[model samples]
Target: MSFDDFYHAHFRGLVVQLRAYTGDVAQAQDLVQEAFCRVFARWDQVSRYDDPLAWTRRVAWNLAHNRWRRLRTARAWLLRQREAHVAGPGPDRVALEAALAVLPARQRRAVILHYLADLSIAEIAAQEQVAEGTVKSWLHRARAALAAALRDTTEEAQDA
Candidate 1:
């Protein structure tokens, strides 16, 4: 069968199967689309397979599994970060978040990974896919900016 014909015949069923595997309709759809892209990339070989739809389903399920693993890791990391901080959102927490918001994106990320997430410089470097020195520089700049902002806030409050 032609690739387009196979896709048209199997897309919805593959999406339904992936949704059962992932328990998320949108993620299932995304995984199925990604699987189709892969299949399209190797249409010559994939179309020749005895069961192209089976191959697509396998790929989609694998993708869904990988996504689930990544999400689990992220959720665990978030839980750890929450445990590192106090239980409730207090004024100080609000002020600190406001200060963090003023930094550039990279700097803010560095600060969060280092201070809030409690990741080591090496860990942050790996996660950011940059050199350790670059992570250090970002953290240093973030700290300076945060200190200045918080100091200004403090001074303003005192004046009030």
Candidate 2:
């Protein structure tokens, strides 16, 4: 049979079979189309075979298997990326967070903006609509309070 005749006769059957194997009509269609493209490239040799349909079917199945393997590997890599291999928050972090929570709102904001956000005193003062001196004062007080709180927590932990 002509290549066109062979394709028209078997395309639907191939897609149906691939869909049954993959459980995805779109993927099955893609696999079948790709398989046809490969056969079209070597139609002369393929047509001589007693069972060209078997060769086409095998190619499509291999395509589906390869896609599944690649997807499985990618899924495993993504899962690894999501997993947190590093340790959880230690005692020092917990103590620091607790200490920060107890401070006044202004002090907390100033400390976070200055240290965590890497904002300069002038930038923080401009953002907070306060004088630079006022920003410095907040940071100084916050530092002292945080130091005292962390020290107390450490002492308590040591005592316990």
Candidate 3:
């Protein structure tokens, strides 16, 4: 099917799928558009897939997840910083963001998927294609790192 036809046929369903994956309706709609944009950008290549719709859905889901990770990370950092400033003796956003920015990719993804996206450990494992134990380990490490980051942020704020 042509891109236009695909867009018309699958738009709503894709949005719903993305929403389920993201746990956010607005992000899902944005991801649906982004998915179509990607499909059109590589139409020649992607169209050859036997099940292009599924391919698009997969890509869109990944995009939605990536966007969520980025936006939420930034927002969380900012909120922490703002709170730190208001608390007059707390962690700052910059220190926290820098700390979180250093996490290994899998640890970061596991943490975001579980806590921010409200996904279960099993769900995160399936989405990330990792073992559930791996996801759990990543989560444990991420939580430890977050605690350390918060401490560093507070220390830095105090020193400032």
Number of the top-ranking candidate, with lDDT as the measure: 2
| Per-residue lDDT over 92-151 for candidate 2, one digit per residue giving the tens place of the 0 to 100 score | 999999999999999999999999999999999999999999999999999999999999
- Model 1 misplaced stretches (Cα beyond 4 Å): 84-160
Model number with the top TM-score: 2
Per-candidate Cα lDDT values, in order, are 0.91, 0.97, 0.86
- Candidate order (lDDT): 2, 1, 3
Residue pairs in steric clash, candidate 3?
81-93
Mind giving the per-residue lDDT tens digits that candidate 3 earns over 133-154? 9999999998899899888777
Candidate 3 deviant stretches above 4 angstroms: 83-160
- Candidate 1 lDDT by residue in tens digits, 19-135: 888888898899999999999999999888888888888898899889889999999998987845557897677889899988999999998889889999999999999999999
lDDT of 1 at 78: 88
TM-score of 3: 0.48
- lDDT for model 1, please: 0.91
The stretch of ten residues in a row with the least summed lDDT in candidate 1 is 83-92
Residue 50 alpha-carbon offset, candidate 2, angstroms: 0.8
Cα lDDT of candidate 2 equals 0.97
